[model samples]
Target: MSFTIYLRCFNGIVLREALRFVHQKERFFSALVRPLVWLGIFAAGFRSVLGVSIIPPYETYIPYEVYIAPGLIAMIQLFNGMQSSLSMVYDREMGSMKTMLVSPIPRWFLLISKLLAGVFVSILQVYAFLVIASLWDIIPPISGYITILPALIISGLMLGSLGMFLSSAIKQLENFAGVMNFVIFPMFFASSALYPLWKIEETSEWLYYVCFYNPFTYAVESIRFSLYSQINIEYSIGIVIFTFIFLFLSILGYDPGRGNLQKKGGK
Candidate 1:
C-alpha cells in the first residue's frame, strides 16, 4: 500500500480509539481512581510505617506516596494495555478484528497502530493522574512534566504489547477477565511498584529476584528516574528490549499461517 494509505489508516485507528475513550467516562475515571485511592488513603496510612532511603534518582528520603507515584503511573498503563487487549478479543468475537486483519495493509502495522492508539489514551490518563497528584503536593520536578514523555511512551508500548500478546492466547471474551486479573495482580504486586527491591530482599531473597527481573519493575523505575529529569539507562534499555520481545511474540501469535491462529484454523 502507498505511504499515504498507511498514514490514513493510522489516523483512522487512533481517532476511533480516542473517540471510544472519550465516550467511556467511567474507564477514564476508574483509571484515575485506582491510583488516587492508593495515594490518598493507602499512602497516608503507610507513610509512617514505610520509609524510603536515598536511591538512584532520589537524593534523599522521600514519602511513601512520592515513591509509589511512578508505580501507580505504570499501573495506569498496565491496566490500559489489558483493556486494549480486551477490546481486541471483543472485536474478534464481533468480527471486526477479522475484517481489519484481512485488509490489504500489513497485519503487524495494524496491530502496532492499535497498540499506539492505546498508548496515546494511557499517556493522557497518566498526565491527568499526575496533575491530580500535584494538587496533593506530590509533584515531581517541574521539568519532569516535559521530560517524562519518552519514558511514558516506551513503558506504555511495552505494557500494551504485553496485553496484545495475552489477547492472542485468549480464545473467549469471558475468560479474559480472569486472565487479566491473573496477570495484572501478580505483575503489580511482585514488582518494585509498591516497595523497594532492597526491602523485598530483606524480607525474601527469591521475591527480590522476581522483582529485579520483572519487566514491570523496570517500567516503574524508568518512569521514576525520568520524572526526576534523570535517566536509568539499564532499566530504560530493559523496557525497550521487553517491548520488542513482547511485540514480536504478539505478531507471531496473530499470524494466520504460522501462529496461534493456525492452530484454531484461522480464528
Candidate 2:
C-alpha cells in the first residue's frame, strides 16, 4: 500500500475507536469521576496528615495533593487502559474482535489502533482532572502541563498493553475481578504513586527495590519529574521498554496458533 493510503487507514481505525468512546458518554464520565474523587476528596482529607519527606527534585514538603496528582493521572490512564482491553475481551466474546482480526490490516496495526484509541481517551480524562485540580490550586508548573500530554500518552499505552495482555490470557470476564484485586492495587501502591522511593526505602530497602522494579513506578516518577521540568532518564527508558514488552506479549497472546483466544471458543 502507498504511504498515504496506509496512513489514512490507520487514522480511520483510530477515529472509529475514538468515536465508540464518544458514544459511550457514561463510561467517559465514570472514568473522570474516579480520579476526581481521589484527587479532590480523598487527597484533600489526607493532605495535611500525610508527612511527605523532602525527596530529590522535590525540594520541599509538597502537599499530598501536589505529590499525588501525577499518580492520580497515572491511575486514570491505568484504569482506562484496562477498561479498553476489557472491552476488547468483550468484543471477542461477542465475536467483534474476530471481525476486526479478519480485516486486511496487519494484526499489530489493528491491535495498536485500539490501544491508541484508549490512550486518547485516557488523555482526555487526565486533562479533565488537571482542570479540576487547578480549581483547588493544586496545579503543577504551567510548563509541566504541556509535557504531561506525551507522558500521559506513554503511560496510557503501557498500561493499556498490559490490559491487552491480561485480556488475551483470561477466558472470561469472571476472572478479571481477581486480577483487579491482586494486580491493580499492588502495582499502584508499590510504585511511587502515593509516596517517594526514599520513603519506601527508609521503611525497607527491599521494598524500595521492589518499587524500583515496577514499570508503573517509572511512569509515575516520569510524570513527577516532568511536572518539575526535570527529565527522568530511568522513567523514560522504563516506559519505552515496558511498552514494547507488553505490546509484544499482547501480540503473542492474540496469535492464532497459540490457542490463546481459541481456547475460549473465540476463533
Q: Output the number of the TM-score-best candidate.
A: 1
Model 1 clash pairs are none
Best by lDDT: 1
For model 1, residues 1-267, the per-residue Cα lDDT tens digits are 689999999999999999999999999999999999999999999889988898888888888898999999999999999999999989887888898898899999999999999999999999999999987788888999989999999999999999999889887889987976799999999999998999999999999998999999999999999999999999999999999999999999998877776665554
List the candidate 2 regions with Cα displacement exceeding 4 Å: none
Q: What is the clash count for each candidate, in the order shown?
A: 0, 0
lDDT, residue 154, candidate 2: 84
- Regions more than 4 Å wrong, model 1: 265-267
lDDT for model 2 comes to: 0.84
Q: Which residue pairs come into collision in candidate 2?
A: none
